[model samples]
Target: MEPCSSPPLLSLGTATTSLSPHPKPIPTPTNTRLAAYYWFLVPGDVFNDYASLADEINEWWWFYDGVLINTSPMGGTLIARGYINGNIPHTGFPLVNLYAHFTY
Candidate 1:
């Protein structure tokens, strides 16, 4: 299987905002799931900070297993990917391929 080319669309919640300062917040389109996928260019310090955060989360989270951390083939990039497999808290259905990604 390949990594996802884009983020998954989640219908969690919504918020409204207006373009101008004086106008009231317009209820633009609600109930829309927006997914944004792009590459972020960061300075060395910021990159290091993200890498450290990923490491710390992976280490502290007991639910993670077989987490993979590496760089892209082109170099100068970092990829941290993993998945969680188990049953939902009260549901007996098997949960699989629930993955997470951290890249820079």
Candidate 2:
């Protein structure tokens, strides 16, 4: 299946963002300049029953091994390309990919 097929919820792909020693706010469609363009899956249903996995990731998206990364207007894109496979674990409560696009 294509990345964009499963709504905006998909495994978060690897991205290039700065990791700071502090906790940063979550990026949205506005305000923050981060952009999660691509959403991918983890091939087969490796963790189909690991729906709760996304919650953990969402809670610590800006954290790398416990350290928080500053994800504000740092340029480039903020792609959450790791939680795609387990996004559709539950129905209705689908996770939508937050893609922030800027035009200035």
Candidate 3:
């Protein structure tokens, strides 16, 4: 399936502004971003029927800006890449990735 086929299930947004005398907050779109993805859990027996059999198995996805851009490979490693507001320098607002092992 294509990454853009689905929307994100969870989203979070943050903002930054200058607090000064006669301060007029600068609304920066560069500080904003979006992401989404889909997830499913199939039975271990069904997965084993396809190919190899393991004690644990699972599948999931990660989305960036309403598009699926990252994935969790079987074996417990996750990787994702995407772009954030390039206009904002040194801001790590666009990076997303995580890894964890399944416990039976």
Candidate 4:
């Protein structure tokens, strides 16, 4: 008789980070008739495969996101938005970010 062998198991994990650069100087809005707030939504996608559990592994890759929101004077609403992609080559490694903001 022969002994049975055990099969290997696999596992996967994911992580995310945010980066906001300094906001350029802009004219301050002077409107109090309405409330104001802003929200920057940046979408970054990750496509990688994990290996079976054996030794812990950690690596960083290049990814990008955009900021989209309204100015403080604009009632803090979402207006025009932009994006970043791999095409925009960055000379840095995995942990980098930038944000822009201003209020009245």
- Which 10 consecutive residues of model 3 have the lowest summed lDDT? 44-53
lDDT of 1 by residue, 1-104 (tens): 99888966974456585356587667888756532112122222121122233453454243335444233333222332222222223133211112333333
**Which clashing pairs does model 3 show?**
3-68, 8-36
Q: Model 2 compared with the native: what TM-score?
A: 0.18
Q: How many backbone clashes does candidate 2 have?
A: 11
lDDT of 4 by residue, 1-104 (tens): 78877764763335364344975579877863432112113343232222211110111111212232222323333222222222233323322122223243
lDDT of 3 by residue, 3-100 (tens): 68566787454547654678777787874433432111222111111211111122222222222222344554443222232332324542333334
RMSD of 3: 24.6
Number of clashing pairs per prediction, in order = 0, 11, 2, 8
**lDDT value for model 2:** 0.38
Please, what is the TM-score per model? Answer: 0.14, 0.18, 0.19, 0.14
Which parts of model 2 have CA positions greater than 4 angstroms off?
Answer: 1-49, 58-63, 69-77, 81-94, 98-104
Candidates sorted on lDDT, descending: 2, 1, 3, 4
Worst 10 residues of 2 by lDDT: 92-101
- The runs of at least 3 residues in candidate 1 whose Cα sits more than 4 Å from the true structure, single-residue gaps closed, are 1-63, 73-104
When 1 and 2 are scored with lDDT, the better candidate is 2
